[model samples]
Target chain A: MGWTGRILAGAKFLAPLAVLLVLWPILIRAFNVNPQIFPDITAVARAGLESIRDGSLFAHMGASLARVAVGTVLAILVAVPLGVLMGVSPGVSAFLTPLLRFFSVLAGIAWIPIATLWFGYGFGAITFVIFNAVFFIVAYNTLLGVSTIPMQVRNAAASLGAGRWTMLAEVLLPGALPNIVTGVRTGLGFAWRGLIAAEIIATNIGLGYMIFVARDFYRTEVIVFGMIVIGALWLLIDRLLLAPVERATIERWGMVRSA
Target chain B: MKSLAIRNLSKTYFDAYAGAHVDAVRDVSLEVPEGEFVSIVGPSGCGKTTILNMVAGFIAPSSGEILVGDHAVAGPGPDRGVVFQSFALFPWKTVLENVAFGPKMRGVGKPERERIAREFLSLAGLSHAAERYPNELSGGMQQRVGVARALANEPDVLLMDEPFASVDAQTRMTLQEELTRIWQERRSTVLFITHDVPEAVFLANRVVVLSKGRVLEEVDIPLPRPRRWDALVESDDFKALANQVLQLVRSA
Candidate 1:
């Protein structure tokens, strides 16, 4: 679609959120809710402005985004090649499938407890949790993706003089890209939740910690503002980033099934 | 172009359903000389594909040697390019990229490989669709790319296994005619496999009929070059050659 068309679609998507924003303060005023219990829109906006002015919002956001970027990047780097190896060899896949399933089942926030014990609090522990959340899902999906490539296609590549590395780069990687992107989307979802949980328990600076700390002061505006930032950030990442990657790979390739 | 020689080729595999070993191909030997088109026709269970698979080095024979020129074939390589029944074009790659894959593998520069790709695509009558992906094309168009991909490699031998089997009859005929036209222009040594009798007879210089995993008969086709479905479909010579091969296939 053209730039204008995309902008129109983006505006349409955000309209519902805009309506909710408009309704939030109206309903809070109508109900006459106490500020201690729930913050009104203006109070939340004021809290957001205060945080921004103090640079605390940017600090927290930067910390969280860095941890997420490092953890997810490391997880993907290790996962995809391991997954492709497992996919290429049935013996390897069979042996690892059970272990992979077990870890995948135990992924995300569940790892936070031990991760804290192993790495202690703060960046290392929280990063480990985020990594746990992304690694298993992406690896499993990569395996699925690689294995799903048709045998005839492999043969064709081979006969056309594709060597080991060439086959992996030209044939296997592109073939598995759609599923890999899907895995990334789902894995990132889990990573975000795990990050928030880990941050609340471990880190002093982040959206989760900001919200958790506000509870002690009965600063419901700060808590609500932090929550809004968290949700909005996730929405932006999903819509602006992951959705376009999926469109480029899956939808463009016509690999998206009804299922 | 290099000649392909299959010596005492055989394949035996365990059949789990039957709980026994099944001899898929047995003691089959064939030769396609340089610049000649040879088609192997057979029934479904007669192991025509198995033999092709062996020659293409996708699978090893039970006991035999496959030679392309003086080089012994042990595994799939650029020397023996294959066009599968499924068309087997890389779904993610554009038609140009798919056709350019071989030269890219051979370490040709981007500009030269793309030039080769465009040349082959034009030869296949698909230059207009160069930037399109395989899924965007019809089955016939896909097979055309498949053929172009193999041909662009300039392999010593071009292996085709029922390359037009999935398309409609009309498209298949058109593909056959196009193939003959391309082969006439650039005579790469070819090994075509199919269950279709007329396809075997129409496309090959000689038709090798197979039954029960062995050579049933090898019928020579002295039919004129530049053969087309429109002119040859009803001609006595084409019918006689097709009928002769069909009877041999049915007799088994």
Candidate 2:
């Protein structure tokens, strides 16, 4: 795009942020809120600078990221193919779908109690929480993707001389790609939230722990800074990474409906 | 031995709404000769697609026999290629991959299969879009990929179900002509199904009119080779044949 188009798009994105910044002071004054309840923007900025200078921010962020990576990757590697297997047979899919749905509904936050009980308030518990947060959702989505592929496409592939293996590789996987990617996006969102909650509750060295530890000392500035960091990190991950991947996959493999 | 034969073919649905017994296609018999282009024209809900599905071995007949070259079709095999109306190309697959699917499925080696795919891709006039994904192409182009994919198997018989129904008027005309040209060159036995009379008359050497899951009449098109749509439009023979086919369909 031309510079004008780029400028317009940038402005479109920043407009909301600008409004939030302007409204922050009004919100603070209108409620007569103490600094302990909600720190001013400058205090939060100073806290952010201090954390970055001390390397605490990077350390916490890195630890959280690693746990999420290990958990989600392991989940995907196991869940997708298993989901496809269940999806291929209607009887299998029908039987398993309800079970998976039951598990998926009880995913993420609900697992924290049992996970902490079993794994004992550390990386193990946190990782387990993240894993299930992603696992059940991803597997369910993958099953939906595989099973919902139009029967006509399967028949078309069969008539085109595609064998069982070829049909799986060519028709089933490609046809289900859009749904699979969508599932990954949604599952990751849940996993991110679960990671933070697990870190606060069970772990001692991640971003969530940093915020929770700050709360013990009434360090409102640090808490506000951490919240900003969390929001910014998620924005970056979703906008720069997952959203683009989802859009590209949809454009590539999805049925494009012309307007 | 015919290229394809169906004897006492029947399909019944036993749903509550359809009642205990509802025969979709009842005791239909037909024979498709080798290297002949045959079109089956039928009214809506006439079970033409059910018959095609049975022949394609996607569905089994309720009670009857379906034979291709002395072999009873137990299930879908590489011998019969089907071109569907929906142009059901794998969206993730490029035109090349879609066309090469048959050979790939048959365990043909990569280099050989790719070469074979490229050749047929050219024959279908889709050589330029070989690298493009299915969603990136137009409806007509996608249908050509479907045709190329079917042809890749080099099947003894090709079955097309309303292949031109989804495309626009201009593309549909072009595709129909292209299909006839490809059929002439390949000389594969083709059973083309459509509800359009002109399309049936223009493409097939023999047109079978079907209504209520049974054959109404069969009309022979003796039009000369290299048939152009514009020239065929001017011919009295084309008009008369189209009229007769249309009348049969309307009455049905």
Candidate 3:
């Protein structure tokens, strides 16, 4: 869509959320709720301004974002190649799929105790949690992507004089790219959520720690402000980064029929 | 162009459902001289496709061998270019890139390969479609791209597996005439597999009718060059040959 069309769609999408924001203060006043129970919209806004002015919000956000970025990149670098290998070799995939499924079932948060014991608390532990969230899922998806390529296409490549490296580069990789992108998108979504939870237990400065510490002093406004920032950041990451990547792969390949 | 020869070729595999060995092709042999266009026409299950796959080295024969200028078939190679019925052009590639793929694999540099690819695309009447993706083209156009891709490799023998079977009748005729016109220029040895009798008579210098995995008979079309359905439609020679092949297929 063009700029004006995109802006209009953005406006339409935010309309309902704008209504909720307007209603929040009125509802708090009507109920005359205690500040400890839930902060008023104005109080939450003031707390958000204080954190920004003090630079604490930026510090927390930066740390969290860095961990996520490092962890996700590391996971992808390993996962994609491993998945392609598994896809090419059915025996290896069959042997490892059950093990992968078992580890995946143990969700990222479930690894916290062992992760801390192995790597100790802080960066090592938190990064391990994020890696766990992304790795198995991305690997599984990559395998699925590679296997879905038509056999005839591979045969065509071979008959065209493609050697092992050329076949992988020209046929296997591009053919499986759409599926690989989907895997990364989903895996990263989980990793983002897992990062927040891991940071609560494993780190001293991060979005999760920012909110969890507020509960100790009845700083309800700060807690609510942190929640909003967490939600908004995820929205930005998905919309600005992941969705475009997925769209590029699928649309560029004509993997999906155009509507 | 190189001659293609198949000797004592056979394929037999155990049918799981039948619990017995069933022969797919039985002791079949054939020869095509350099630059000859030969069509192998048969009904479904007559093993024409199986024989083509063996010659193209997609599958191994149970016995005997196939030779392309005295080199025995091993596996799929750049020496034998195949055109699939599905017109298996890479969807991710533009028309130019798809045609360039074979040369690219052979270590041809970018400018030289693109030049070669463009030459073949124009030969196939698809120069205007160089930047378009395969999915954007009609079925007939995609098949043309397939032909262009195979020819760009300049293989010793071209193997086509029902390349026009899925196209609509009107478009099929255009593609057939186009094939003949290109063949006249390139003169690549080709073994085309198809079920349609008139198409067999329309494109080939010689037609080999096959049934039950063996050769039924062979017929030659002395029809003059620059063959067109429009002109050949009225000729008694074309009808008699098509009828003769049709009868052989029916008898099998």
Candidate 4:
């Protein structure tokens, strides 16, 4: 597509969001809603500016993003190689697939209580939650991706003089990339939610912490501002970072015809 | 001397769940002289692909032996290049990169491999599409790239498994002509597998008819060289040979 077409596509995505923003303030005024229950648009905006001016908003954002980054990177580094190793052997993959699935299901929020107890309610506990959220899903996806490569492609590579290393680098890795990337996207999503939950329960500095602390003082404006920041930050991360990576991998490696 | 020899090769699959022994290919033997074009024609489930896979060393024969020149076939290697029915082009790689893959694996230098890949891509009539990924091309184009990739390895033999089966009839015919032209220029020994009788008759100097995991007949085609698709298909000799092969296949 041309530049104009891409710009139009971006505009199309933001149009609904623009409409929602316009409706929010009107709804609050029309209902005469209590500020304690839900702050008005002006109050939330002022709280947002105040936090930004005091530099607390940046600190919270940095803390949250850093934890997600460290946890997710660590998880990917460990999971991908292990998954590929397991996937290369049918017997091993079959034995471990159910186990991986079971753990993935029990990942993320479910581990929050135990993580806090083990790590004593700080960075370790929160990072552990995020790590748990990303690890199994990425591993499972990598395993599935490697296993699903057609035997013909592998045979073609082998017949063309591919050694073990060449097979892994050229055939296995590229073939499995679409699945691995998709795994990362999904795992990151779970990690994002887990980060928020962990921050609320265990940490003292993050968006989730900021909102949770505000709730005790009935500072609905601050809570509302923090919620908006969380939503916008997640949208940016997904759209700017994770989504594009997923899309590029799928387009480059997936066999689906490009439209 | 034959470029490839298969001696009483066989394969059997044991179905553990059903407790039954199934023979896929049984006591099949064939030989192809150097630079010869041979097509194996068989009905579905007649073990034609099994034989091809064995030749490619993707699968081991349950009995007997296969030899390429003086060496016993032990496993897949660069000596034989295989073109699959599915094309098997790596989607992530560009057309040129896919062709270069073999030479790269063999530890050829970057510049030399790229030059080899470019030459083969042009030979396949795809130099214009060197940068395009596999999914971006049509089925026929992808198969052409597959041919180029196999040829790029400079293998002693080319093993093709219904390489044009997935393309439309028109594209398949074009691809066949292109393949014949390329083969004429390169003079590589080819072993093509297909169920299409007309295709087999058109392409091969000898057609080996197989059925129920056994060789039924070996028919020679005395069709003249530099065969043109329109003229050859119109000739009485081509039709007669095709009909004879079709009859053999149907009866088998």
List the RMSD of every prediction in angstroms.
Answer: 1.6, 2.9, 1.7, 2.1
Error of 3 at A238 (Å): 0.9
Between prediction 3 and prediction 4, the one with superior lDDT is 3
Q: DockQ (Cα-based) per candidate?
A: 0.86, 0.71, 0.82, 0.78
Candidate 1, B47-114: lDDT as tens digits: 99999999899998989899999899998999999999999889889999999999999999999999
Candidates in order have lDDT scores of 0.92, 0.87, 0.92, 0.91
In model 1 chain B, the worst 10-residue window by lDDT is: B225-234
- TM-score result, candidate 4: 0.95
Mark the 10 consecutive residues where model 4 chain A has the least summed lDDT.
A250-259
**Cα lDDT of model 3 by residue, B104-189, tens digit:** 99999999999999999999999999999998899999999999999999999999999999999999999999999999999999
Q: Put down candidate 2 lDDT per residue, A171-213, tens digits, no spaces.
A: 7777777777888888889898889988999988999999999
Order of models, best lDDT first: 1, 3, 4, 2
Superposition error at B79 for model 2 (Å): 1.4
Chain A TM per prediction: 0.94, 0.90, 0.95, 0.94
Regions of candidate 4 where Cα sits further than 4 Å from its true position = A1-34, B16-18
Among residues 3 or more apart in sequence or in different chains, the pairs in candidate 2 whose N, CA or C atoms overlap within 3 Å are none
Worst 10 residues of 4 chain B by lDDT: B1-10
| Candidate 2 CAPRI grade | medium
Q: What does DockQ come to for candidate 1?
A: 0.86
lDDT of 1 at A209: 93
- Index of the highest-DockQ prediction: 1
